[model samples]
Target: MNPAEGAGSLSAAVQAGLEGTGLASLSAGVRRLMDAYRSGEVPAAPVLTSAREVAAYAAYRMPATAAATGAAFAQMRRGLPGWTPATVLDFGAGTGGASWAVADQLPDAAGLTLLEQSGEAIRLGQAILAESTSGALRGAAWRRWRLELSDAAERAAVQDSADLAVAAYVLGELTERQQDRLTELVTGAAPAVLLLEPGTPAGHRRILAARARLLAAGYDVVAPCPHQLGCPLEVPGDWCHFAARLQRSATHRRVKGADLPYEDEKFSYVAAARPGVGSPDCPAGRVVRRPGQRKNLVTLDLCDRDGRATKLAVGKSKGEAYRRARKTSWGDRWDDAATG
Candidate 1:
């Protein structure tokens, strides 16, 4: 489905899940949750401890999470073309935001499994997904599984065969060692893996670390990166990330106490697949930043296949290239062949 339609469906599902919820309680829960997230420290206990908190989280965070994950999924689809996962495993699934995002991309996937620790989260997730039109989502299995790095049985259980495994916005909650272990678990579960985190320097670093591990495991880089070479933005004060803009609903605005009709969800992600599973259609480069346009010139900041970040200026003299460059936005694949 198109993005607009998918978003509408997601909004409807969330609204359906939120029916009969108390707005005052939801707003209070949102404030507390926002404070915890803003503090940047991992909570020692489950964040969604009650139905009110779960409802608040679903109404407040699900849309943005889905939008960001959808953006990442879009890139993955573009890179892999005809490839589709028959089964999907979503680790740290939360309210199944990542699963919904995957459903938006591959609606016909036969199976989906969501593993989360919080029972409340699982309950709300099941309710939210039950409202989805996609059969895969409606039939998704919600498992209450805590991430324990050293538990052999747990690890084996999480390694169920699947085509794709996703862990989005959940890395921050783990220790560095746990993060590494989770990566191992996901990679063991599926040939293809996608990881996403907030678009912060620390988040980018986490993704870069996971990317290195995936490459070491012989997986091919699929999206955002055109080549398997080391990241060029690894230097201090620079990080690779992308943004997805989503419209805020009335409930969203009230919970966040924001008047803006839209919000941009910035995220850092890496999608990789084992050898022979999938390969990226190597573009000339990717637009790493917003394109700047002038009267007759467009400047694009690109991370090219050579693993270098540089700027390209397309002037009116370049004809069609200039037109395409002018229309290009951040996070777009920059194909020199198409431009020329």
Candidate 2:
């Protein structure tokens, strides 16, 4: 289905997603409710997270998600530090883990607003905040974090005015129309908005769309190419997916209590914001290409000046069936005579 056509109700879209899919399971009643929400056959209400200790058939991924987001925010600080943003809006702030990422960074900021439409999410955010900041909350100017259950449109008028706005992995949950609307909302709220995704093709596609919109709107892009460049061919598929594996610690595994799926590459993200119009030095990813090389040799190079790349060797077209070389090496580093 076209994502753009479903922009009117973001909640309905998410409610539908909560129903069930091959990747995740949902109860039959929940499926019916979600379907009704998606079709707009019924009015939507905020649904909170069940509970912190609500026996999950799986582990509570909140801590890991929160930790990863905090790390990403730290990277954002390294990239830009001149602006000490006063107000922040965390859009699609599921359970407030990403919001904690923002709050942790701007500990002294005046206002931290967590905008979520789910009642469950709102409750979870409040509970986590209460537990995490019990004593030190008063040290921050705005000791109390604001949890509001509101739609994106309702918040758009005052959106981009924040110092920094973030929409992390949440973009994947949004439909096409909702994605566009949400982007516009964040851009409206603050001069600099950071959009992070799972680093999948679909995730990258959403970031690309935001880049196009922000560029046309005159916002400078900070990280990742906003130029909408073609794929780099790092993998065979349309998107890049790597495995991330972490050994189960006794304490950690016990906390999660499920056979955690730890792949080598679990997540990826891009940091984006309005570019300072005249400021140069935009970092770009490396691109490798070979115009003409030996039948089995591929060239290694980067398209950008700062971009760096290495190459590997693989088999050329075959008669019966095609196959790849056993090992690959950086194309430029390969000694042609020795390689041949």
Best by TM-score: 1
Per-residue alpha-carbon lDDT of model 2 for 1-340, expressed as tens digits?
A: 3331133222122223222322222233234433433453212333224532211111233444554565555545544556556677777666555665566667577766666655555544454454443222222122222223356546644555577777766666666776777777777778777777654666666766776677676776554332334434333564422222333322234433346533222344445566652233333332222323566544333323232233333345431111222232111112222233
Query: What's the distance in Å from true for residue 117, model 2?
Result: 1.1
Per residue, candidate 1 scores C-alpha lDDT tens digits across 1-340 of 3344344477777878888887898899998888887877777887877888888888878888889999998888788876888899999999999999998778679999999888989988998899888899999998888888688887778675799999999988788998999988988888889999989888999999899998988889888898999999899999999999988777778888999978999999999988777545778898888889889889999999999999998899998888888888899899967467
Q: What is the C-alpha RMSD of each candidate to the true structure, in Å?
A: 2.2, 12.3
Cα miss at 192, model 2 (Å)?
1.1
**Candidate 1, lDDT over the whole model:** 0.87
- Residue 287 C-alpha lDDT in model 2: 22
Q: List the residue pairs that clash in candidate 1.
A: none
What lDDT would each prediction earn against the true structure?
0.87, 0.47
